[model samples]
Target: MRVVFLGLAVPNMNEYHNMFTELVVEFRNNGHDIMVVAPTYDEKVFGMQVEDGIPTLRVPTLELFGVGKIQKGLATLLLPYQYKRALKKSKIDLNFDLVMMPTPPITLVNVASWLKRKYGSKMYLILRDIFPQNALDLGMMNPKGLAYTYFRKKEKEMYFASDYIGCMSPGNIDYVIRHNPEQNANKLHLLPNWAWLQPNLGQQEIIKIKDQYGLLDKFIVVFGGNIGKPQKMENIVALAKSCTTNKDIFFLIIGGGNEKEYLDRMILREDLSNVRVKDFLSREEFFKVLQIADVGLISLSENFTIPNIPSKSLVYFNARVPILASVDLNTDFGTHLEAIGAGLWAEAGKTKKLKEKLMYLYNNPEKRKKMGENGYQYFKNNLLASMAYENIISRVTNT
Candidate 1:
């Protein structure tokens, strides 16, 4: 089968940890041809850097992030069609069997519809984050009369265009169903997260990374991902300040974000040594450093109602490091933690709760280890890439 993975992220700084890569690899290994068309600016490649070893296309895009709201919105409109044309031109010998897609930009829906009309192609919507609604919840979208109606219509058009839709968790499915009750259930399948096998170097990798980061002797809790508004770093910063008395515990945050410069400024203004912030580390360094982390932080802003089941939590779990979340326990994430016994959760914006949870995890190595092991088990049984691929294969083959 031939496939085109439609993405609205850059080639790098895509925090899904080569999520599309892993799926493409599986399909390729199984004698399928796969291609990816994504929005990536050469200057702003975060984790979604242009990866090698795959048939890929980089469509010039109107960049998102930072203070440029107008340009970003304009870019989202053109991105979908730009991606489709790029693929159509490049893979002249091949046409996509399925266009697997996700978005902050809903243009792909129209692109898929174009493909369907032009070549009878089917679209698989990987609803990673529900736009407009998620954006509305995040206070990004202006939910006023005209703008609301226009964007809402676009959202439905995108959904209606998709032949099959996939969501990361049941909560996400529920949210979608809540919005579009008439949509077919069989079309809205659960798209699980995935895990990668870690290279086993025991404590030596940790010791080495610690030494390199000048954190060898410190109890470091790593929040290694984008430091965007979504992460709500203010809460974590408060937690770092609270831990100043602990002396041995340090908050190590490593990743790039539109908010990276702001975080840098915050660190300086607060005069914090307990919180060591690093820009996006290289992929090789990122993986190696994670192996040494004592704990990983999974966060989403509180008051965020757009259903989010973070994929990074499973990555931390697969690395055998427990997760420390700053998200509301009322969500599916907290339920997942309790269900798998993977880690602890705190209210999204509560600095006191974050501090308390971090301290407790630091003191309980046995529990942390147990949670890590449990997370790995859960990843194997549930979130591995193979599971999602199986679902894709079943649908693609109609078997």
Candidate 2:
């Protein structure tokens, strides 16, 4: 089958690794013809290339970084039109069997509708990030405002146009249905965020990695991902502040985003010797860090009602690192971690509880190793790329 996968996330082959990449690779391996339509702000004209044996079309869209809220919103609002123009200009055969897309700029209903109409393609919505409502929950946008109304309409249309809606979790599914009661019940499916890390580090290699990262003798608590507003990263700073007296415990915070500078400022201002910040590493380097670390951290803003299962935690799971999740009470993310004995959880922004959990894990070496093993085992059994690929195939074929 020919599959067209669309997303804003254009993966760098040498550096980037995510669930999307994993699924596409598996699709290619399974003998499906894959076409990736990803966004690029660097190109004025649409660029076409073959990446890692898969044909890719880079659609030109407005740059989203270092911009104010209004500018960012305008750019996102224009993406669908830009994407449509690119696809039409490419003049590729309109014969895709399945067209899968994830949400962020949730204005893809127009493109998806066009694809379905032109090619009789089955549209699959990988509902990773729910919009409008998420913005409303965070007070970023007013529900009664025109912008919210506009996005909400697009969100509903995207759902209505979708042949299948793959939700991140049970909570996500419930939220969608509850909010949009008009949506078809049969169209929804639980498509978990997958983890496909294959680590083969020996004891010596692990020690070498720790030494390389300056975590040789410290109890490394690693937070490896986007340090964006949604992360509620101030709580992480609070955690570091609370643990300042514990010389053995170290915070290795990696990744960059809008809120990253705030963390840097806080670390500097407070003279928090226990905390360290670094830019994003290549996937391989990140795995090495994860493998060497004693604990992994996952966080979400308390403002979010959307059940975002941060896919980053799955990377930690694959590395056999015990998790320390600070997420909203509404989300199932922290709960899932605790249930599987993969990690401990605290409410989002609750520094006191986060400190307590961290101290417990730090003091208990046996528990740390045991929880890490449990997470790894659970990941192997239930959350792999192959499993996700199979689920996608089943949905596409059996529908």
Clashes of each: 11, 0
RMSD of 2: 1.6
Candidate 2 C-alpha error for residue 65, in Å: 3.9
Candidate 2: tens digits of C-alpha lDDT, residues 57-80: 888777876677898898888888
**TM-score for predicted model 2 compared with the true structure:** 0.96
lDDT of 2: 0.86
Worst 10 residues of 1 by lDDT: 43-52
**Runs off by more than 4 Å, candidate 2:** 14-16
Cα lDDT for residue 166, candidate 1: 76
